[model samples]
Target: MRRVSVDIGGTFTDCFLAFDGSYVEAKALTTHNNLASGFMDALGNACEQVGKDVETVLSSVDAVRYATTLGTNALIEGTGPKVAILTTAGYESTVPLMRARGYGDGLSEAEQANLPAANRPTPLVPVTRIVGIRERVDYKGEAVLGIDETDVREQIRRLVDEGAQAFVVSLINSVVNPAHEKEVERIILDEFPTHLLGSIPIILGHRVAGRKGEYARTMSAVIDALLHDQMYHGMSSLEMALRKAGYKQPMLLVHNTSGMAQMNSTTSLQTIHSGPVAGLEATNYLSKAFDQPNLIATDMGGTSFDIGLVTADGVKFYDFNPILHRWLVSTPMTYLHTLGAGGGSIARFDRMWNAVEVGPGSAGSDPGPACYGRGGTRPTTTDANLVLGYLDEENYAGGTIKLSRRRAERAIQEHICKPSGMDLIDAAKAIKRKVDHNMAQAIFKEVAVKGYNPKNFVLLSYGGGGPLHACGYSDEIGISRILIPPFSCVFSALGAGNMNQLHIHETSLYMMLYDANLRQVLSDFTEFNRTVVELEAKGREDLRRQGVPDDAIRARVEVDMRYGNQLAQTGIVVPFRRMETAADVITLLDLFSANYATRFGEGSQAPEAGVRINVIRVVSYVEHEQLRLRPSEVRVGTKPVARAQRECHFPKVDGAVSTAVYDASAVAEGMTIDGPALVESPRTTFLVDPGWRLTMGAMGSAWLEKITK
Candidate 1:
């Protein structure tokens, strides 16, 4: 059972090695020059702990799962290949215009509300590169205008003349009928054969996403085509590296869907933020193991904070129109949210309230912080944390990157204290408090908006800066329980170990279950059953192609149900795999109504307007064995080992106080260290403030519980 999992993050590449029963975790600075170098370095560190060499580890391991941020970084760095888009003739402006609300797609509510400053992201596919062909298709897959082959050929030629390296064909309602898209691909192949380097790769809109949003579906295809070459080359090189190192099995890649797939089956969009999604998967495993039915997973890193939810009822949250690197895509990706509150987030003075404001701007790794001596002068959350005495100046990042207290003070005093007319300590305290409140509000909305109570969920904190500030934020939202799981630094890698091989297939259709406007309920069970079966068969075929046995395969049926012409669709997981009886149809309607009532408020149902299933999905999978870690029994003690003592200032307490600092390795299981203490590990620091106690648990896990007054 030897396996290695790696998560390549923005700041670090985390590695987790499972050698038989023992687990070892390691981290290394990410080197963008060659991602494999950083990956190997991190893996080497873990192997050293297990008394193994690189060749021995790679050759012996059953699998090596990777969940990386490469796609995210590539998108942010604008390193993808030049792409051209082709769509229906009338929809040339779709990508540039986006949806009227696309400006707010990936923004905070506050930023979205401030419409004056709102701006759409730069178009990935420019107007000059976007060419359209004559085509028209109705929502029901009926062709209104016949295929214009001559028009398609000319449009491809024009795009090629304009230097289109890639092509996307997104005809209206292609999800329902993809004949026009198929024809366009045929013409593209015939005009420019694959043997020529000039031959462009084409992506059909329906193949990437099975939904009916014209603009979103088109953008999905465009982004996929744009990133295909980059991801393919990157993944292929990695596979070759693994092969050279004596590894044989396919290099399984983790997807944001909470599933693992081979590189051949994964899309670039599926790989974005996969590292954080792995963290969420780890949280789900923890929830089940500890019997914590509801949990909120929070990963607070240097540049972003990710939040994911797991409910007791097993209600899967999905975004039908998710934004991928600023492009709204009609794909039902697993729902996760990222907030602009992290260690590198800049903190500024709020002139209006005479308070403090945290960031939408980050001092990323390149310029870093003023303390990093990279010439960054801006005051950031890290600067505030340093000013508040939470971080050790000489021991940050294992002392690999030294911090400058003077620089931190100057940055804060000049940028925040003087502007707000407050002392440095007060200004730092305000910044911390404001950021915590911001995160708490975001978590509240994430849960409450989905008709769940924040108070009912246990907060699972991970990442470099999570535990340091978990108490500050979770307490603000009235969340009492916090679990910092074992191998918190490599939690996402742990998630990669727990994933099942899965494939999802879906198709868009305009099927009315109940036409309330005309006062009619669908009695056509054959059509309904046929659609579900077709989707299931597609999913089954995908799994079968992946080498899954028929007997081992499992499937779940889901329908995107909506009332009237509403933009929002509620996905309902149907119990019946194939609807045969009227009673089954009635049961589905009841389930949908219940889910709708829970989400958008009761009595919001508009069945009188109409009821329809816009999309049908099937998730096929062969469940694999998982890695299980036992939870430690809670023990009470008041003894602590002190490595050193430092004069630290805490916002909850007045003035500077001498706080005890201990190495995490020194803390044994069942040992407890109380208030005003710092537990320093190689990968992260746990700052235990006054009124909270830290308990060491099994498998490097720790609990930060609030002490009663």
Candidate 2:
């Protein structure tokens, strides 16, 4: 397969090219002003490695896939049109109140646990711009009160007069019955006709998400509308750039759902955190290729560290109601945990801890790390790494940007050393240790909270900065094996190339599989089967439009079940496609019970209280030819040669050690690299800490194992 996938990050743009089964990865500094320049530059680097030109590569590839942080960055920068929301009457505070926990929606656990210090995120729509529509719809799709079309038009006019650039119609129970929302859309369009007044995009809540929670669903539609213009224009520019370079196929976009779809089929909400999701996808493929399961995929980039999980049994994990930039939205995105611990994460002296603090703030590409000599004055993880002698000042990022050791020393001394009364090396050591501890704690909590043991999983580290600190954090978290997957630097981009054309359709409903009050089982399967069919049709239509045959499209069923009106919904995967008989219902109940037990505990299944299915989801996908990671015979006898020596400092390891630095490329497949050692690649560095060993594998995959006493 001839394909290309690019992941545009905060600090860099990564490109992964698959040219007739020969895979190559490349990276370029992100050009934020015009993203296409960065994309083309990264792609050009990849092309040059294989002796190909830009146009020739673009014109020949079957597809170009992108997993980008475009929407995330835009949302963070608040770069979007003014949004006006039209919610149901008496529901004006729904989005504002944020389900009473708006204060800590996207915050860390420590922040969430503090109630007095809680504060809501800045409103996406001003209270004055949010007008209520006089309409009512019950949960079961029954309209109790009629919608006022004249009233909607008047309210819309009021909001438009208030400088509303876009509109969001999110009525109560809109997912159950979208009649009121549809009417509002029609009235808005009539009032602002596209032919005369120009096209004005009006977002309807029911179309964005098929969930019942009004607040989450409303935010989903609002976010979708907010990101619509930015995502469209940005992605459109990229597509046009690709087209100019001779690419004719539709540019596929990776979704936060861990699925890839054509731009025509993507929603702005689905594009959030897509880069991290793609990295998880690549982790999944590697897990299968390398026959390793229960892996933790960790990506330590310049600005952030993202962690994702892949269970041994291949059960996909998803965040049904994930938060994006501090706003909760109803979207079933692939589950990923991101921390502000990266090379560019700012390090500071913490008065409280009397030590060091890593970030929730980053020094992005503009004035990167202080060591980059970009005029940054703050101490950062990169500066600490540089001061510790782990990084080659002259060869960082393949020498694209030269590092200033003096700048690093100055930043650390001023910000950390002087304030804490510690020496420069000591302060740098504290920074590294603190950041590693923070990451370990984050990973531990993430795994533990999900009812899994972190010790049971292998650490699959990628990204440019991951291998540098893999040993530090993994040791702290009680992990031993670290598999830096093939093309580790551009791993997320590689994951994008493996995605299939996919779509997900779902509906929120109150389904009682077993009514404890009546002591009767839900034996009749008419409604259950009908809902599944409806969802399947929607997904089928989506795939069919994308040129997939009905026979080629496959579907998976998922039901969000809970016990006794519990707010927590456990998504249970239905093994069978659809319920046909009484036996199928039993199968679903057993599946839900087992899933509940696995997540909570053996004694936590309270099916006797009641079994309710709140949501039904159907995933439709057409598989593509994946880039197979062909295995290499495990040859462990090859010896590696050292290229140079460096005096590097390791935290908790007392004195500076003279570490043998090896040319990463010189290490043949299956060669063993012993510690204390450093393997230097143009794009990244692999640190073999004391008591750990590294082995090179096929397609640039490496294994780092602990040497136990």
Candidate 3:
């Protein structure tokens, strides 16, 4: 297969090209002003490596996939259009109130604990723009009061006159019944038809999120409406750029749900954190390819450090109500936690500890790090790495940019060293150690919370900064083995190439499998079976709309079930699509019990309280031919010649050590390099600390195994 995939991140844009039997990787600084410019620059770099022009390569490629942080950046930067909400009468405070817990959404545990410091995110739509209409729908899907057509028209016009750029109709209980919401949409369109200059896009709550929770569902629709124009224009510009380069195929977008779809089939909410999710998908592929079913994937890039888990048990983890930026929204997103720790993470002196503290703040791409000499005066992890002699000053990013050692020293001296009583080397060492500890703690918490042992999984480290600090963080987590995958710099892009086209459809309803209240079991299966089929049909139609054939499509069934009146619902993927017999219901309860016990603890199952299914979901996907990857083989004790030597400092070590440096492009497959050593590539560098050894493998793949505790 001849294909190209690209991942646009905060600091850089990475591209992966797979053709015939060759794979190429390329990188370029991200152009925030115009994402397409950075995208084409990275692709052009890959084309140059293969001796082809952009037009020639793009015209003949099978498919072009994109996994980007565009939507995420827009949300963080508040670059979306002003959105107005229309809801059931008397719920004017729904968006503003956002529930009591909404104030703590997207905040750290410490910040959440400090009540006086907690505050809700700035309102996406002000209360004045959130006029309510006379409409009501009960949880039973019964419309008790029809929406007044005149009321709907007047409210939409009032919002428009108040400078509303888009409209969101999110009446109460819309998930169970959308009649009131649909009527409001019809009224808005009639007042301002598509052909008129006052026309606006209308986003229905039920269509954006097919679940319950009035607050979460409404926020989902509001966020979708806010991001609609930004995503559409950004995506359109990218597509136009591709067309100018002679590409005729429709561009596919990677979604955070571990699926891919054409632009027409995607929603703005699905694109948040897509780049990181694509990296996790690559980890899933690596788990099978490397014959290691359990792995911890870590991507430490310029802006953030992301951690994701993939285990041997075929269980996929998803967050049904994940917080996007600061807004809590209801969407089924594949779970991946991000920490504001990376190369550009700024380091400051914390007076409380009399030591250094690394970031939840970053320098991003523009003005990058102090070492970049791009007007960045703040001391960052990148500056520390450069000061410690891990990065070559003249050869950084293949000489596309030069590093300034003097500037790095000046930043550290003025900020970290001056605040504390420490010298430059000690300050740099402290920054490295602190950042590594922060990442290790986050990984441990993510794994332990899931009831998995960090020691049981091998760490798969990628991104530009991952290999450089793999030994430091892996040792802290008690992990002895680290696999830096082939094309590590563009691993997420490679994963995007292997994704299947998929769509998910679901509905909220109350169904009892075992009623502890009545001491009875479910005797009727007709309603349960019908809901599953209806959800399946919706998913099938979605895939068919994207031109997928019936034979190529398949479906999976999942349901969110809980015990008693507990707010936590455990999602279970059922092996059987339709439950016919009483035994099938028992099987579902058993599945939920087992999964719950695994997540919480053994004997934590509360079937004695009651058993109920809150939501039913169907996943329809069309499997495409995946790009084949060969397993990497390692040879031990075959040492490669060194290119040079440099003096590097390390934490917990006495002083500067003479480190042997090797050019990554010149190393032979299966050659080994023992620490303390440095492996330098044009795009990234690998640091092998003392007590660790590096084993070279095929296709730029390598292993960093710790030799000592």
Deviating ranges (above 4 Å) for candidate 3: 634-636
Q: Best candidate per lDDT, number?
A: 3
lDDT of 1 by residue, 36-94 (tens): 88888888889999998888899999789999877887877677777888888888888
Locate the minimum summed-lDDT window of 10 residues in model 3. Answer: 628-637
List residue ranges in candidate 1 displaced over 4 A: 100-104, 114-117, 350-355, 373-377, 398-407, 410-414, 417-424, 517-521, 634-638
User: What is each predicted model's overall lDDT from 0 to 1?
Assistant: 0.83, 0.89, 0.90
- The residue-level lDDT of candidate 2 at 436 comes to 92
lDDT by residue for model 3 (1-709), tens: 7899999998989999987767889999999989999999999999999999999999999889999888898888888888998888998897788796788888888998896788777878888899888988888889899878988888888899999989999888988888788888778888889999858989999999999888999999888988899899999999999999999998999999999999989999999999999999989998898888989999999989999999998778898999988898998999999999999999999898787999988998888999998889999999999999899999998889899999999999999999898999999999999999999999999999888999999999999899999999999989999999888878889899889998888898798888997988799989888988888888888888888898998999999999988988899999898888889988888889998988888988888889998999999999977877667655756788898999999997979999999999877788888899999999999999999989887778888998876
**Clash count, one per candidate:** 0, 0, 0
Q: Candidate 1: worst 10 consecutive residues by lDDT? A: 364-373
Q: After best superposition, candidate 1 residue 336: deviation in angstroms?
A: 1.4
Ranking by TM-score: 3, 2, 1
Q: Give candidate 2 misplaced runs (Cα > 4 Å).
A: 196-198
**Clash list (residue pairs), candidate 2:** none
